[model samples]
Target: MINKLNKSYWENRYVNNQIGWNIGYASTPLKTYIDQIKDKSLKILIPGAGNSYEAEYLWCHGFKNIYVLDLAHQPLDNFIIRLPNFPKNQLINADFFEYENSFDLIFEQTFFCALNPNLRTQYVDQMHQLLKPKGKLVGLFFNFELTEEGPPFGGSVFEYNSLFKHQFKMNVLEPSINSIKERQGKELFFIFEKKS
Candidate 1:
C-alpha cells in the first residue's frame, strides 16, 4: 500500500512550500471554461484547492457560492489574507472525503494526480456523491502513465475512461488545445457531467 496521505502529510508539504502542483494562477483551461459560464451564483467546489487561484479568479469575475477546500490550513489562511472580503465560511479546511456538501460544479486541477492511486475510485465515488444532479466536473487530467512515485502521479485517457465512464457522461475528454506552455502536451481537458 502507498504511504498514508493524511492531513499532516499535506500540511507539511504546504508548510515547507513544497507544492510544485501550485501553478500560482488560475490555469488557462479552467479560466477559459469559467469565462463562458453564464451564472455568477452557481455553487462550485474546488477540492484540494491549494492556494486556490481559480477560486480567486471566480470571485473576481462575480461568481459567488465558491467553496475552496484543502486539508491544510496554510493555503486557506493564505487565501483569507489575499481575499479578506471573501466569505470565511467558504474557505473550508477539511478532508475532501468527509466533507458533506453538494454543488453545481466541481473544478479539478492537479488534485487527482496528487492522491495515492489506491484512492482513485474513492475519489470518484466522493465526487459523484458531492455533485448535485446533473452537476458537472470539469478540469484537466494528466495524460501520462500512472506510477507509484508521485504526488503528481500520472494517468492516461484509457485509465480515465475506465474509471469514470460508468458514473459520468463523458462530454469532452481530449487533448487540451490551450494548455499552458509548461503542460502543452501532457494534459487532457475534460468535462464530465454526473450521471443521474
Candidate 2:
C-alpha cells in the first residue's frame, strides 16, 4: 500500500513550501470552461483546493455559491487572506472523504492525482456521493502513467472511465485544447454528470 498522505503530511508540504503543483492562477482550460457557464448560482465545490486560484476566479466572476475545501489549514488561510470578504463558512478545512454535501458542480484540479493510489476507489465513491442528481463534475485530469513515487501521481483515460462510469455518465472526456503551456499535452478536461 502507498503511504498515507494524511493531514500533517500535507500541512507540512504547505509549511515547507513544497507544493510544486500550485499554479499561481486558475488553469486556462478550466477558466475557459467557467467563462461559458451561465449559472452564477450554481453550488460549486472545489475539493483539495490548494491556495485555490480557481475559487478566487469564481468569486471574482460572481459565482457566490462556491465551497473551497482543503485538508491543510495553511492554504485555506492563505486563500482567506487573499479574499477577506469571501464567506468564511464556505472555506472548509476537512477531509474530502468525510465531508458531506451535494453540489451542482464539483471542480477537480490536481486533487485526484495527489491521493495515494489505494484511495482512488474511495475518492470515486466520495465524489459520487457529493454531487446532486444530474450535477456535473468538471475540470482537468492529468493524463499519464501511474507510478509509486508521487503526490502528483498519473493516470489515463481507461482508468478514469472504469472508476467513474458506474456513477457518472461522462459528458466530455477528451484532450484539453487550452491547457497551459506547461500542461499542453498532459491534461484532459472532462465533464461527467451524475447518473441518477
Q: Which portions of model 2 show Cα errors greater than 4 Å? A: none
Tens-place lDDT per residue, model 1, 5-118, is: 778888898899998878889999999999999989899999999899999999999998999999889999989898999999999999999999999999998999888898
TM-score of 1: 0.97
lDDT of 2 at 5: 88
Model 2 global lDDT (CA atoms, 0 to 1): 0.93
lDDT string for model 2 (1-113, tens) is: 25868999999999999988998999998999999999899999999999999999999999999999999999999999999999999999999999998999999999998
Q: Estimate each model's TM-score.
A: 0.97, 0.98
Q: In angstroms, give how far residue 167 of model 2 lies from its true place.
A: 0.7
Query: Candidate 1, which segments miss by more than 4 Å at Cα?
Result: none
